[model samples]
Each structure stands twice: as structure tokens, then as C-alpha cells.
Target: MTNRTFMTVEEVAAELDVSKSYAYKIVKQLNEELKKLGYLTVAGRVNTNYFRKKVCYSEV
Candidate 1:
């Protein structure tokens, strides 16, 4: 029930077609790799928001 774009571990796993256990592992690893600022976690949870390039091209 949060308005954040970030998804939970189980949600991400479903999106990636993986098991919850694996999802947990992946999220943990991502956390280590990201080491991002404003990292919000509750009671040891795996959370992440994938990043992407935003290309802006104007038609001439």
C-alpha cells in the first residue's frame, strides 16, 4: 500500500519468473552492489528499483 515505484522482493521475483528464495538472494546481492543513498528497508527486506537511461531525441 505504498505509492513508491519500488517493488518488493516477491514482486520482483514474479516479474523475473524466479522463486521467492532466489529473489531474496538476488535482492541481498543487489543491495551490496547498489550501496545507494536513501536506502529504505524494514526488518531486513530486499528492495530495489531498477535504473534505465532516458534518451531524449527531438525530431528535426
Candidate 2:
């Protein structure tokens, strides 16, 4: 995977093997959660580490 601080919607879709629309929804949901936790969020991207953790992507 390329080194990136945030993942775009396309990247999220590709990584999760889901459609772009679904990826957008997922990003929105995750962003909302982050906002609730008082974390700043960008509009069409998510923090890479947060995404991996939320999706349970192990580094093993």
C-alpha cells in the first residue's frame, strides 16, 4: 500500500472490495464518529490508522 496519512474514497473502496458509493457511506459514518469524539476530519478522506482499526485490518 502507498504511504498516505489519509485514504480517499476510491482507496477505501478498493481496499474493502466494495463499491464507491458504499465506500462513501462508510467514510461518512466513520467521519461522523470521529467528529463526535472531537477529532477533525477531512471531507472525502479518512485517517489510515483509524480506518484499519475500525475495519479490523491486522498487520500480521
Candidate 3:
């Protein structure tokens, strides 16, 4: 298992510079994708490493 943990919608909003509603939408979308892949998801939060990869693609 990885050390990566989950992030709240507030953290997602700050990280994406988006509104809370938008953050919820993003989380919901990610959660749906995870569900399709047979992974369990939590409400109002997302996996940190996955979130980073989704939004921080420019990092080295």
C-alpha cells in the first residue's frame, strides 16, 4: 500500500483554485471513475496521489 492518503473537498478547491461546488464536481467525477475501476470511494474526499496526478500534470 502507498502512503498516499485522501484529501477533503476544501483541499481540492484550494488546490484547483475552484469553488467548493466545482471541487465537489471534480471529486464526484473522480469517484465515479474509481468506482468503474472497482475501487471503493469516500464521500467529500479523494485519494491524494490520484488527485495530484489529475491536477498537477506539469510537475517534474
Candidate 4:
């Protein structure tokens, strides 16, 4: 990845090797969780670190 703090739906899809539609769903779900925690979220984008943690994508 490019060391960005956030990942767009496109980037998420590429990273997960999933379809863009599916990636949008994932982003929406994770954003909901973040909202519950009192964090503001951006539509069509997610925090990269949170994404890695949620999906169990350990650093290599």
C-alpha cells in the first residue's frame, strides 16, 4: 500500500481481492462500528489500520 492513513473503497477492493460492491459493504459496516465508538467516518473510505485489524491482515 501507499502508506495512506485512509483507504478508499477502490483501494480496499484491490487489497482484499474482492469486488468493489463488496468492498463498499465492508467499508459501510466498519464505518458503522466506528460511529458507535463516537468516531467520525468518511463515506467510501476507512482508516487503514482499523481495516487491517478488523480483517486480520497482519503486517508482513
Candidate 5:
């Protein structure tokens, strides 16, 4: 494993090869999904494990 618990928008952009704005959009979507599940989320940041689990099953 990794030491990371969360990822910033910039890191998400690089990891997904997306623009920062797009990354923010993606992060927002992730956060929304989490909120639907009763998880609290922070703006501009996402849980790394949660991202992996969601992205792994999606087109990304």
C-alpha cells in the first residue's frame, strides 16, 4: 500500500490526465455520491481509497 489518505485537486488532475477544472468537477461528483451515502466530504479533496474503488469500476 500507499501512505496517502486523500488527494488534492491537482493530484487528481495529474492522476486522471485531466484539467484542474475537470478534476474539480470529478471531485464534486465523487463528493456528491459520498454525500448520498451519508459521508461527509471536503471541497477540492477526495479520499484516495474511495476514488480508487469508484474509478476502478467506471470508465474514468
Candidate 6:
């Protein structure tokens, strides 16, 4: 229904009229949880991506 894009922690904070520190904390915690589920990771400073599913390959 919307064309908005993913937002960084600071952006979310500004949009929500909340503290940046709180946003940063929530983002950091969520990132950790995502890592545990193997659905997200950091490509660089503050870069995170979520895949729809897991992928794996094995060599015989």
C-alpha cells in the first residue's frame, strides 16, 4: 500500500519523534536477533539485509 523504503535508526527516530539513542538500541537488538536467525547481516557500517529464506550448498 505504500512506496516508502527501509529506514535507518536515526530516520525512524526522527519520524517517530523519539530519541535517537532509543532507536539505535532497538535497531542494535533487532540486528542481533536477526543474526541469530540467519536472516540478516551487516555488509558494512549500519548495513543490514533480510532474506526471505535461507540458502545452502554442499560439495560432494
* Best-fitting candidate, scored by lDDT: 4
TM-score of each candidate? Answer: 0.53, 0.92, 0.83, 0.92, 0.85, 0.52
Candidate 2 lDDT, 1-60, residue by residue in tens = 797889999999999999999999999999999999999999999989889989998552
- How many steric overlaps does candidate 4 have? 0
User: Model 6, stretches more than 4 Å misplaced?
Assistant: 1-5, 43-60
In terms of TM-score, how similar is model 1 to the real structure? 0.53
Residue 34's lDDT within candidate 1 is 49
Give the whole-model CA lDDT for all candidates, comma-separated: 0.53, 0.94, 0.85, 0.94, 0.87, 0.48
In terms of TM-score, how similar is model 6 to the real structure?
Answer: 0.52
Clashes (backbone N, CA, C under 3 Å), per candidate, total 0, 0, 0, 0, 0, 0
RMSD of each: 7.1, 2.0, 3.9, 2.0, 3.4, 9.9
Candidate 1, poorest ten consecutive residues by summed lDDT: 51-60
Model 5, residue 44: C-alpha shift (Å): 0.5
Structural RMSD, model 3: 3.9
Clashing pairs in 2: none
Backbone clash tally for model 3? Answer: 0
**Candidate 4: lDDT of 25?**
99
Query: Which candidate, 1 or 4, has the higher TM-score?
Result: 4
- What is the Å distance of residue 39 in model 1 from its true position? 5.4
Give candidate 4 misplaced runs (Cα > 4 Å): none
Q: Write the per-residue lDDT of candidate 1 for residues 5-29, one digit (tens) a residue.
A: 5557776577668898887776676
